[model samples]
Target chain A: MSENRVPEEIQENAAHEAAKLGIGTDEWVAQHEERTARKKGLKGVPQFIDESIPAWARWVVLLAAAFAFGAFVDNQYLLRIGVNLGLFVMLSYGLNIVMGYAGLLDLGYVAFYGIGAYGYALMSSEQLGHHWSTWLSVLIIIIGTALLGYIVSLPARRLFGDYLAIVTLFFGQVFVQLVLASDNITFPWADDYVDITAGANGIPGIDPFSFFGHKFLNIRDYYWLLLVLVALLTITISRINRTRIGRAWRTIREDALAAESMGVMVNRLKTMAFVTGAAIAGLAGAIFAAMQSAVFVSGFDMPLMTMIYAAVILGGSGSLAGAVMGAIVMSVLPEVLRVTNYSEILFLAVLVLTLAAVGKSVKRFTINIVSIALIGFAVKILLGFASIKITPTEEWVVGPVSRALSHWMYVPLDRVLWGNCAFVILIVLIAYFTTTTPRIKTILLPIIGYLGIFLWEVRLVTDVNTTRQLLIGAMLVVLMITRPQGFLGKPRVEVL
Target chain B: MSEKKPLLEISNIDTYYGVIHILQQVNLRVDEGELVCLLGGNACGKSTTLKTILGMVKPKVGKIMFAGEDVTHQNTPARVKLGMAVVPENRRLFGPMTVLENLKIGAYVRGEAAQEDLERVYDLFPKLKERSSQLAGTLSGGEQQMVAVGRALMSHPRLILMDEPSMGLAPKLVEQSFEMIANLHSQGVSMLIVEQNANMALSVADRGYVLQTGRIVLEGEAKELAGHEELRRAYLGR
Candidate 1:
């Protein structure tokens, strides 16, 4: 204990030195403590959440909640959404291995999913007059897609970055074309054209997954199966991420030349990553085909690919839990948007949250909200004085919040045009706001906020599909500006 | 010195990038348990020489013998597996990875028996042990250099190829880096260091080769090269 303690003479000498510097020891110590406290405060809530709970425990709790929700939920629509979330989770996980871990931009990932579905359809349906067992069909499809992935990677081995993306994207387009043209294939040896993929009409009456005669006919049954698959895949992928192969993938992602110099077989590991991702996507596709009891060419198009990429990127591409969370959000957000009242509530809540987060002070937040209200009322009064006919509150407004705001906001008869113009002006204002001084920015905030509400309530809300996409784009843009690493991705330090 | 076995010998290597000649008829060697430094000014093909030996760039006309085997056409990973390690230019540390992970990657060819080597590396740089969990990018320049050297040592290589180890270090740290190199040389580890800093490199090397415009203009014992009038005027600045 004596050895561990500072000597009394040394302590007195430190005090003497402090006195010589015109400061007391206590004052200096207090300042040091304050700096540390401020540093801790900067870590904030997210850091608290990260540190207070172990990852595995959090995962367990999340999975348990999902299981309880799925098991007891009565609505079929909700069950369907759960099933779709599980499917997206599977696809996002697959894409994560390629783009997140290996840093390969495989734009043709959905083609593998399509292949799985089509393969399952051909093997287990009346389309080709073959009815193989579901298990056998799924197994063969998974292997076939993995083999296809390997073949695709052979040409991709020498290619990198944008070139790889271009080639894979070409493969995706080729797959769609082949599927479309296969319906009228005329072999050189054959005299007549043979219909194969049924063209755009697609394959119908696909067999449901059956385990010893217990057919998974109900959406609930498929939901449970998908939930299990997602759980198993999450565990498997996470385990793989901790292994030597995963480390090699990450090294290659960081710098391939350095990885190769370090004795990692970069090409082989890249192919392995591609194949693994393809196989996972293939598995999801097989289950999707079985669940729908049909396969369509349109189902595996660019839009689905975009959604999967969005899920992976939004969740934080390299993170397992991030992929799942991103999938859930991407899948369910549109469904929530379909209901006007829910989306309205969601928008308002998000708006308030953003203000609270960005405002930093209570006074600023209050001022912003009050200014937005005042601006809305002033605009309404100005329009009234000009003799512009405002639509009655009960005519078009559906949600409670929108109805209440009808008094303050001006809803024109030609809302679509007004909303369009407002949207453009809002965009310009936001752009200008970014380039302005802080004082101008504060002045512009309420105006922009009021215009955003106008655009949403009057125009954007009616066009659900476009609005959903616009929201996603806006989210991605904001995320890139604020957190380029995504929600859970660790910020990378690129070599100079 | 003549009886010493050559661990790596490169003869008459000609390297080109799209018909622009980078290295022409370059010959170099590092002997067993020897510290050899390749000295040159900027863009004198010193890095190219190292890359050619490492099988990163294919030489149009050359033979490379490493540890008594002809390895002229082998790939980078194959060369790496044949007991070669590199502390590349700019350190090239996996910036997002931990210090320990970067070291572990150096043993990729050897597989999971690097625990002992890891301990040895920790012994060599005790500062690294305390910062093992810290990301390599966040480390100070001296600490990052320590990790780079530690990473190379994890491979348990027959020879290490270092490209500009002193390039980004503080002046004081440069002396420390050379001391670390001298310490490793004393422990019987072979090394081939490519450097523009001739005075520092020659101070610790046994043999030295001075390259000029993709040609080896001078080759002799380190003391002889250091004392040579022409070498001193161009490189030593004396």
Candidate 2:
């Protein structure tokens, strides 16, 4: 209907350069959508995002919305989720400094978080014989973590590439081993063996942070505290990124040899990055320990680390705002999955969003939804003709949506074994769906969608932990494909 | 000419990539305020020489001197701090950073005068001044090359080494970049430019060294070497 504002010459020039750069012509969805929108004489949503709101203002607005969300929500579960989101935001930012800015993959990053939590537990708990003040404990923990980060980084100066990864990963494993087995210690000429770490039981009754004698007692209190800290951290980190140190880190990230030949102290700057990440992670760990009033070795393991990494990667590393966005989505998602009704809504909502976003046109998206619903009902009718009645347990289906879904879909009476089979079948169908032609793809999608719903209603929604992990894994895969630079990160190009 | 010490001198340098020799008995030099070119085709160790001088590649046996001091053992940053700045192959500007930030990184060793040096770079490349806030990756190839040169200038080095400045630009832009190089040379900045663009480089350089399979096969005034028929066929691709 309209001639594109972007001229043919500009398009040719971009394609020419992209070819020279060896790019395969695939671009991020947001960028591709904007061009399509311009071609169709319609203004894209992101055009406003790109041209009008500066990145900093967007961050402020988003942060303000988060603050508002925290201040108003009265549900303790939601507030607890809010607090956990805050911790993840902090964790992502810290890891962003090391992995994103400096391009160092420190697999043992969570060890520093564990260290900080345990440090606070020891300092502020009655088990340590004398409870220290919260301010002093926090100060000491931060300082100690920074030093620990520096010490750990010293041995890595000689290692580079994958060798560095091996050393750091081993360090992470060592931290877990120490925490697990450090139950008792016998000193030479000592009368008895002492329990330094309280032996696997974990140190509990950690004192909450108190400022001006006002202790942070409620979930909302920790949420507010983290919000302010995150704001401060975001500002401070943004400023740091513009300094001489930040530039050096970026140069090293781009090309370490080139950076070194350009006069950057690459090793030292890398270490500084490690120290910064560790300090931030430790601070988050301190808050997390206080929130639960306990520090457990089991809670600070590899899976928790994966969650933090997911947030960092999801948001795009090297961006403060990206980290926050990723953390909020990831932290809130698992909590939603914990409740059957909420999870069902979330699942359907995500499915709808994916279908709408991925389909070529509105008509196709609508048709797909209708076809999926019809396919499910047809399958149910066929099963009914076989004289078998399938109904899910009533206890798990309380919501109006489930009640509506119950009437049309065949919910297995004994779901666990059948649900497992459906999940495996769903996976195989999804794998095949990717390989089929568009015509076959259209035919197969409704079956896949119906199967996905069947598996979720029967098995997945009930197994919250496994489902959350699956969501996180799925998020990582989708993020890597759709936006590798992360939502707020600058797209990077490597020459070799 | 032989009595006066060269600003930089590399003698009998032998380098290896694992077991394979990359640079064999390589020798080259850049006099103060003189524009020199190391001309070669692919697999001729042109890049290895630059890397050796920058101390990114340690020579198995060699002596590298800058202003009469041995620098063969020095690491890259040490060489850079000792007044050697490089426009690495393909510009290598921090792609994610602003042009201003790229210049700042170039002057990483000179912390106190970073601002003043940045101003000087902006003066040399005035177009860079107008677009200093833009990301380096977003700039055109010609502008990126200018930024690379400007970044080198910001380091305030006694010598600047550039690798393949004309590799990706249009022919007209290549001519313009060469003109800029000659202009910078006229302003008393010594340089050793490494290039596969022999015709363009020889036009600007005072002296030329044609490298083949890690050895210097020809060395003379740029004008005289450009006129050599066989050398022209192999390297200039005539």
Candidate 3:
């Protein structure tokens, strides 16, 4: 709105130009809005909101919010967790471009993150690797991540919808598996002579980020570091989203055929999204490695994928706030799970059940319920059979279906009979309640759901088994049936 | 007609989409300030020829000469910058944008002094100024078409190409749209209009070409084309 204000100097200058052009003030304004609307579409909610918040003013709010969150949480450990969450916010924002704006799902986002992490780790660590200054390492990490992103994008740009996703996921999984399987390569930065990535023990005493000879070793310093990165990431993404390139991405997402018909180069836009998202993930990885003082293969777990996606979905796909919220829940949930007698599985179960019970009467609530139930079921089944021993599991990659079925069916089939009954009962209850005054019947649903989740979680299920994977498979089916968009993600509309 | 030399010459243009060859050896020419109409029924390659001229698609083999320069290999933006403008089929106005934004993007290929063209376009279509802030998509079909035309005009193009501007229009709007085209002609802008309504197109056209399948089967002065027995029987529903 303040853009309405024209200083006298500008008005005078404008008047002189107008006299030469022989055009009136009203005409100029009308044409400006017309041009802007064409450049920015009607569904452009982000830019509309962004224009209202001035840059300098926003920074002050960001700093205040960060410090307040740090001070109020009071625990240095939690604050450290918060810093990690911020790092993920940077990562998710990057991922949002490829997966959100460009409609390209990239599962190998973390591989770029690893590149940056290892770029810094190998250069900065003094154990089995050569030592370099933190500043130089930081530069190397950024360049390395960008290069990795570009390399991956060459193939990724050609893919779209689900194929791109599967390939990227495969790419990321292969990288992690290689690191885990190859002990020779990982130990270069290890303290021991035979350790690369310290063989799961992980390298330690990698120097904290030292720029211009000033080291940032404390949580407070790390918090500032994260804030700076998050802000830069947000600004860069926001600007890119508003520019001509961003318009091309949206056009492609909306209708690729129509976009190409309009002479927009579709391949170029897709490549930009893939590369940019990878770069962001890489940046986050570098910062994370610096904070943790080491890189570990175990850090890039499959469960971390679920958590990051959950955050992205919960916050709102393509929305920065959604990414931030998603990262926060993911980074902190495990820690919170550790503190309570209720395991992380139970925490998620309870959270989901409560949401579903409360959401039952709401139209479109069933979608949320289904996804939550799936997540809960996943956690429940995975946690229940940690004690069951497995024999003769291969070290390298297994075929997907076999691997999936093996993971879910590992424990004694009878042990999960109770879980099957409970899951069936929940489904029956959901189905039965939908027909009549289900709202009134399930008035106490939230309490009942959380109690069910709590009862299962309090038993401290630890070792992951086949039960979790089955739950996840069930969850995917439920998602396709109920809320194809998943909870909090915008349902995709197909307009021919 | 002054018998001025043709500024744009098209020869033996063959355009294909996969197995469907849309334009076959389509030869056409336009002298300076002449309004030409490529008239046909729906799906008769009138639109495809316009697109080929705009460089939206490459011809299998043809020479497109603009001011004696070969531009068949040029891209859309390059062609546009060379004083070419198109009111695309279906009037693909940027929907969520204001009427003004629709016009602005039309002149997007134009450099910094685009405001001059913007004013010229608005003066040409006063209705656009009235609903300047209104989202182009929400506008009535007729109004949207006006925005599309105004947008093309914003580029200050020497030659304007339009495709099916009369599609899905009420009779009155269609009449007004043709009148506007005639008015544009009076302003010295050369035009190549592709229209399914042969009657309306020939009314404003200095000359007309009748296309069937992908090739031009008849070419003559507008009056002669209008009076032709075969064309009238085939297209004008005589």
Candidate 4:
């Protein structure tokens, strides 16, 4: 027992060694572990939710809900919106493969969609005196568009970043110009000029999609068709992502040179991405043309391209679920904006949501909202004293939300002019608010809130299109500042 | 050392970036199970030699033979499949991807049957197994270096080309890196390491080649190169 017991000096040296190694006492170690565990518990909640639910289960629930909504909903307008959303979802998925997975900036992606539509239109319609079968036309369009996409991406193979974007953009413009000008063609050996695309008039009388003697007649039919296609696409793309090809594509996106050195064929994979994306877009285009019973070059213009890009970005690039969610939001938003009642409700809801988000504390949020209301009433009274004629509520305000807002907001007789002025001033105030001190920001918050409502009621709501664009722009700016990775994307750490 | 079989042979190769010649008459070789270091100062075309061997940059003249086959005109992926792998400068791990994903990407040519290689990598660097799910970019420099080397190993390459394995690592970690390289060398894995730290590199390497500008200015056994008066005066800071 005496031999087993350590000497005093040896024990002291052991303690010194433990201290030198930064190994704390048992209690201290336990306390440190507890603190770290608490922190991890807080962070792990969201991640736990993510991991607990399998991706397949979530997708099943989502698709089932979508299917139920489309199947039962009798309203044609709503069904049309659903169908259009499905179309946009398909486009986003296609773009996600190219720009998200492979990181190629194919600005001319919509051109593939246009080509598919036109190809289907020509093959199925009497435009070129051709009435190809529905399945055959769609198959041909998909294959032809994929080939075109491969050819288009050939020149862009050596390009990167902005240069790649420029080349693809040029291709997009070329597609548009070719479609526009090809309406009239007089060959040296021809007797009469040929009408191909029919110019600005577009190609009309395109056949509706029919399979196994079942014609897709109603908006609901198209909606169901799109939903099926989207579901299939989702499964296929996600499967591809989990496979070697998808990993190769992502590696190329991350670092092409590294991917190449790692034995991933960068150029061939890039071409494959382009072709797959183009083929998907082509399929969507053919369906879209059939649904609309026409194909217009204008329909596949910059605005549509912008919407698809915005949807992909908003949803979170490189995420399949994000693309679908973004497509739903972008597609439904404009339609919601078209209706005055829905638009008013949306505007106020967003305003309140923004306030709640910015003012994390309930007290701060309350103070901001109260101040905004007080300022609005005070401004109305001041305008009354200044003899500025306020418009009567019954004359202009239609919606219940607008009617409620009319009491506080001082809508002038010439609201359009007043709104225009407020918009410019609001822009300046927002710019100033971002750069100023916190105290100044508190003061500016109420003012900005009041002005935003003022602009919405007085000017913006009247111009639905502009308002939608402005709102989307503002949303993107805020999202970029707060969460650049978007709703579903993982936060990436770039080495440089 | 007897009857040496060169796994990678770059003979009188000249490479250019547009009109600017980057590597001139760069003749180098790595035999099976040998550790060779390519030593040079900054911008002395050390990296270009690695790139040319990997077929990222096509040499204007001469040939590159990998595993005794002509790979001069072959693209990077082809060369990689021919048993070449590079631990690139700055440890270019896919920042957003996990350590395991990066390793899997290294096995891109070999396909999904790299589970055995993956386990081997983890066995070599057990700490990497713990951090396999963590992003490669978020790892410490030493850890990242391990992942980079592990990633190269996942390819099961006959010749691993390391571009500055010691760069951006602490002094202690630099010693550890060389030790790891020495360990790998002993395991019969061939390597062609490009380095600016002549001392550490030459210590682990069996033989070394010194490049000046774009040409191989000096080539000898590691012991001789370390003791050379001119080498000591220039790179060794004697």
Candidate 5:
């Protein structure tokens, strides 16, 4: 008490609070220690970063790193990934404005992006026979998108939460439907049909941005362009957040009714947030259009929107830095998954991470890891009695990592049925284990790990896209379960 | 000011939650530089009456006069600008934001002058100043209550509305909170505090209103209300 170290009282009270929450004394203590240590660790690093490195220096470091990556990665496929990642960064920033700052879930945000794409495509495409300059086209697209956003927000902003979500989702569907149906339209008054939207095949031959007679032809150019734009948007958005408007938006998100009482014009500000997010999305769409030199409705569908949402949510909605990290993860995950070696390493790393996080103590963690090793031997011995054919490592091994895995893994030529069954069983076992006693969980974990590996080798390994999708879906689920605030996001305390 | 008119005058207001008629003909008032407590049990529309004054819950029938202006139809922020501030039920501080940020938002409608108000709040609650950087949600119950009250004060309102300031606090902390409320009243800040703890409310209040089942059953000076036999059985547990 004399030293004024306040944790003594708080720690005592935390025990009582934990008991009320139904957590055991030991578990609560451990969690508290971890939380306190994490806070201490975070405090030091952020202080060091802020004090030692100026904001400009940090940006310089980031830009330098981005450029170095661009210069080093020579493969066109890798460059394409860079561009995609940059685009994802932009999209996440756009979505962050509405979802993070305003706390409005605009499911039809993709439509704004689509509007930007089509707006640019129409003015600068061969189909339209009007090749506008890059500056004019982008300006028109942004303004048009902002206008569309303002219009959409007129009705949607008044709708609260779920209702707003539904309206925006319907708007997305409408955009898709209108574009899909607009191939050949018969006017009510006129006889002849007009080819307006170019329909399902999409409007092609869109001109790339030629800035001052300097054309952006290569994937690297688009990648650089997007990176620069992302940097610019990040600065702009952060500045906006520092203003009274930003504080007002956050207040609205915290409690709309409370914010109103605090003298904030809730509805109008929400509308403004929508328009702002829309403008950014539109800019990203314009760049996307120019990069691809084509406009397809397929690129602006639900999955793309989901990917963007996942990035924003994963990074921590209100944090720009979190958004960037999340965007890069969401973008590069599929590309990494495309390669067997990268995906295998990632899966094993993640599994190890999960084990370390959940294991509680070092002794327990060691036991869990050891149990996994023992499970492999036990399964192998059991398989011998069953007379199942275990293929030689030579046949299935693709990379050095898999070659090493071959010694332990149960690889078989005709194992798809068993593999799929193992995957389902693994899920069930994990679920069941959670509900069971600790002893049961400890005993079943090894089997669960083996089953997971079996599923990975047999089913997930053979398919890249599906594996990527599974990993992302799992990532989202894990995020929701473990930490909804996402990486770099502050843990939110939801007040009732 | 202007012959000592009531700072907040809620005249026979009937507030409803979609025909539920949560508050019926509920009349309450707080004169300048006075502390008034509205005491009631659960769902007795004490909070509804406060919300009605704050413009969160519109009255189906009545007049709410603030500084002699009819503010029944005015919006929440407009009322706030006209010097109305609330420490909401459950101390609804912006959970993710720092205590400083929350306090800043309390003076949000005040704009540039908020810094001075913030200093004033800090002066009242030194603990808030010490833990200014800590998130509002992470604070202990007493600390959160302090932040909530401090936030309301940041608006530098002519009249402050408090909703259940002592609900989750320990007995000692509740006493401390009431003392702070009393301290504020002494400093010429008019307040309308709604609470279920009739005993605590009465101890600090200059005037008190007793509400039950959406109606004001009694109203008098604090000393009279404290001695009311019915209030003793129902609330003070005499």
Candidate 6:
């Protein structure tokens, strides 16, 4: 039937039928709108985009901009970096829902990301013997991820915060190990399950995406696709935040007992945030799968988790803008560092020192002067030495020029001196910054108040050689010392 | 008002938090439109009994019959739906929510009665309407108490449970709250109140129960309880 031929009574009937079935009118309208939009071949129909331009035209304009910029850069390599940044933005926004808004710590968020990538890979790759459309796989990826999120949260959510984070992290590790150890569960084309994941070797022959019979092989097209997804994700999260359910989530975050007292279904809202966050991660993962069209164990490793957590923290934890900005920084900074040819250890040292020098109590100009001087000093020392030799890995080399410069660089004494200087500068910066900034001082003040309070925590994690132990330990100490609630968390007082 | 059944009946209710038994064998009853106070000193089982009745704490034993329904094991939200509301001790307002939002949430289970009951609440507390958009936490103690009382009134409950309405208030505000309570009692809203201020509670209540530890020590007409030598000496500082 034509759209016009559908009678008003019939439409009204469709809307009201759910009410007749004992559902609330408001809930009925929401569900009916969702169903009707799906049947009518419209996506986000009720959603308002700018009236001046159709959404499709806006997307075209964005795609054109990305392509033009990519071409101007004169490097497919830089274009690839842009694409990776776009994907991280998507993941970070998704993570923001759990960590930022809902205030749940999900350590193994990458499990859903992995599920999406693998789901798309299995369906669309040549290894599967037949290719499913990327769009179809994307849909499947969302469903798979949402289901996984819901299931994982069912048991995991019984525990709160640190306990939940550990469980999720364990879940991710177990999932990865299962794929590595088992062969029968994987497709027949793979010699082993480990081979599909490539345990270490990684999977190849992953096909580029073709959605709605249109192929988008280049980074430029992927950037456009991801930008649109990111926009939609933002809209979804913003709407949820404003909705009654979102208000419920915030109430639960503030005080679970109080929220329960106020007649909110606290457990339900917590579950929703976890599942929704996971689902969004899955969506990003599907796009990621299509972007790379390849798989490997290292692709979804511990570093991915670190980057996500860093993004959440660096951005204002509960703020939407914070999460988005955090993701963008986390994604782009590594590439920027790669281009600049800076050492990760050196970068970390500088960051820590910079953070210290800019402490809350310090004058603003002092922070600026100290930060600029430190940067200048590091650059001068590196340029002056010009003859040190050290090699970690190709990724860690910082840049091609840095690798070349390292050949003639100093070996023992100079290297030690540089390291020591950086350390000393970092300590000075920390001391200066802490004394200056009350926020930084507040963080350290707790530890000062109870000297060596975290010594037991440090000793407990000494067994785990992984960098994760340090990250977890530092996060715990920082959280406990600075603001027990969180860095930017709101202080909530109990009524009785 | 009804000879057939009391508006609320509490029979031998015991409440515990872990191993600490807070309320033991607590019994109270309110006939339709009757104003009653569960009176006690600090650390007494009055608040615990009120919480038990509101389903904030489930009774370890005994049934809570509200409007002839067994609400012994029902949750707070469920109890709220059955025309039961509480003005909890210490003015348990949603700090971030605007005063209006706090009132709106109180009527969450009110369903269709929201608009009418909201109007009634506004009429009852004009100060709330004036500062409806203000965050409840920012309000002064008396104003917060007004929000708390207005929120309970929005439910248009058959039985309103109040726990220490006069606590932490200045003398003038405490008198004002008690005066408001008297007005609400006269408006035919049956209520079960718990209070440290025995004289004020007894002055308004038609009947009163004196609880010590977890058990009711005295039960009588409000006038009789008000003049009792033991009660006056112990609680009223007479």
Local error of candidate 4 at residue A271 (angstroms): 0.4
Q: Tens digit of lDDT per residue, candidate 4, span B105-132? A: 8888888836789889999999889888
* Models sorted by lDDT, best on top: 4, 1, 5, 2, 3, 6
What fnat does each of the candidate structures reach? 0.50, 0.55, 0.02, 0.64, 0.52, 0.15
Is candidate 3 or 5 superior in DockQ? 5
List DockQ, one per candidate, in order. Answer: 0.33, 0.48, 0.11, 0.41, 0.45, 0.09
Clash count, one per candidate: 0, 1, 16, 0, 0, 16
lDDT (tens digit, per residue) of candidate 1 on A55-170: 99979998998899787998999988988898999999999999999999899999999999999988888888988988899899999999999988987789888999999999
Cα TM-score of candidate 2: 0.88
Please name the candidate that would achieve the greatest DockQ relative to the true structure: 2
Off by over 4 Å in 4: A1-52
Candidate models: Cα lDDT each: 0.86, 0.82, 0.68, 0.87, 0.83, 0.67
For candidate 2, chain B by itself scores a TM value of 0.96
lDDT of 3: 0.68
Ranking by TM-score: 1, 4, 5, 2, 6, 3
In candidate 6, what are the lDDT values of residues A67-138, reduced to their tens digit? 576557657787777778777877777777777666677888887888788777778776556588777778
Model 6: residues >4 Å from true position, as ranges?
Answer: A1-82, A126-130, A156-158, A183-200, A298-302, A341-413, A421-496, B1-5, B110-123, B126-134, B154-156
CAPRI-wise, candidate 1 is acceptable
Clashing pairs in 1: none
Model 4 in CAPRI terms: which quality?
acceptable
Specify the poorest-scoring 10-residue window by lDDT in model 5 chain A.
A24-33
**Which candidate's TM-score is highest?**
1
Best by lDDT: 4
Please say which candidate is ahead in lDDT: 1 or 4.
4
lDDT of 5 by residue, A367-442 (tens): 9889898888777778867888776667667677677877777776676777788888988998898899988888
Taken in order, the candidates have interface RMSDs of: 9.2, 7.3, 10.9, 8.7, 6.8, 16.2
Q: Each model's TM-score, in the order given?
A: 0.93, 0.88, 0.70, 0.93, 0.89, 0.71
lDDT (tens digit, per residue) of candidate 5 on B1-238: 3566687888889888986989888788889888999998888888888888988888899999998789999988889999998988888888778888888888878774356787899899988898898777667777788889998888889998899988877666788899999999889899999998888889999899989999999999999999988888888876
* Candidate 2: regions farther than 4 A off: A1-51, A62-76, A158-162, A189-191, A210-221, A392-396, A494-496, B1-5, B18-21, B112-126, B129-131, B227-238
**Model 4: what TM-score?**
0.93
